[model samples]
Target: MTGPDKDEAVERAELLLALRKRGIRDRLVMRAFEQVPRERFVEPVFRNLAWNDQALPVDCGQTISQPTVLALMTTALELEGTHTVLEIGTGTGYYAAILGHIAGHVVTLERFRTLAEAAARRIGSLGLANVEVFLADGRLGYRARAPFDRIVLGAAVEEVPSALFDQLAPNGILVAPVGPPEGTQALMRYRRGPEGLEQRELGLVRFVPMLSGVAAVL
Candidate 1:
């Protein structure tokens, strides 16, 4: 297909520019976000609005995270190539793809079997072999791949899951949106230091509630 029209291109440019405006200055993070086509991750009906700085609905009541929020969460983690990352809530597998681009290996968990399968296919088709998608309750983390160098939750949880904290390696980082069920969510960054786990509230943000157990329908 032809490239987006001038107005559409301007909108797309503004999206990334807005992210930079919000202090998502990490070059690697920005490049990865630009490289991965957000348009491909959403349904065809929403493709025209893909570049907008807004969440669009996908299958199974899940929404593709807004790009600014995604960049914020990713930049907070500060991933490196050697880090083995575990991602919770593999919605559309877009965030996992970004993590896979920066980290050594990314093990992403999805509670819905259908989402997991779709993510697996998307990642494979993209030729991202470093990513492994799992259909499991992400709140438990992945014991088989314990000792993650970094853990990122795509959905918001009321509290950090103890199991996830245990799975983090010494000096590892965990970034998530934590707070009440409503709109008041804080983007928190937890570091498992030699002394103990330390938490810092980065900024206010919002995300879909992180749920336990698989989707009953799917």
Candidate 2:
């Protein structure tokens, strides 16, 4: 506990406090936030800002989501140790890395090859064996790993894609932002019930729009 180690610890504490003030009380989500090192997920140039309550840029124009948003969304999922999670956006794999500590397995998708490859490397370096990164259109969902216990979309969409709904296991939970790409989106949580899908509105948030098809350009 010296030099950068001490500084990072302090920053992490402050970040957690901020999350608490924002009303995120889920113990498991807080523990995951405290455990994952967000600095490792951002570009080296922006590492200094990693602990700040704001999104920071990564490669391929993607930004590592603000810790507050991540914490809130994770809390909304009410994850369990046995749950298998699906993450739609894998920017820097930070969220996936956090989920790795909570969920049994995390399967994350990144449309950009560079982001997906780089995220895989970072997650590997952390030795998170339960997390897997894929380069593909997140909208399609992963049928091979169908019926996820929990699914979260990192980017904003006009509505939750039908494909994602199909992939959710019975009684599964899902969280996403739903609204027009240019306007503020409502953060929503959905649960598949015996009769139909039950929805709850969490809050408003702005995120990069969800795009279809795998990215061709860098």
Candidate number with greatest TM-score: 2
lDDT of 2 by residue, 1-218 (tens): 21344587788898999999999998889999998888888888877778888988777777788899888899989899999999999988999999999999999999998888889999999999999999889999999999999999999999888999999999999999999988789999999999999999999998989988898568
lDDT for 135 in candidate 2 is 88
Clash counts for all predictions: 0, 0
Candidate 1: lDDT over CA atoms? 0.88
Query: lDDT tens string, model 1, 178-202?
Result: 9986796999999988789899998
Model 2 spans > 4 angstroms off:
1-6
Cα-based lDDT for every prediction: 0.88, 0.91
Residue pairs with clashing backbones, model 1? none
Candidate 1 weakest ten by summed lDDT: 1-10
User: What value does the lDDT take at residue 155 in candidate 2?
Assistant: 96
Cα deviation of 174, candidate 2, in Å: 0.9
Find the number of clashing residue pairs for candidate 1.
Answer: 0
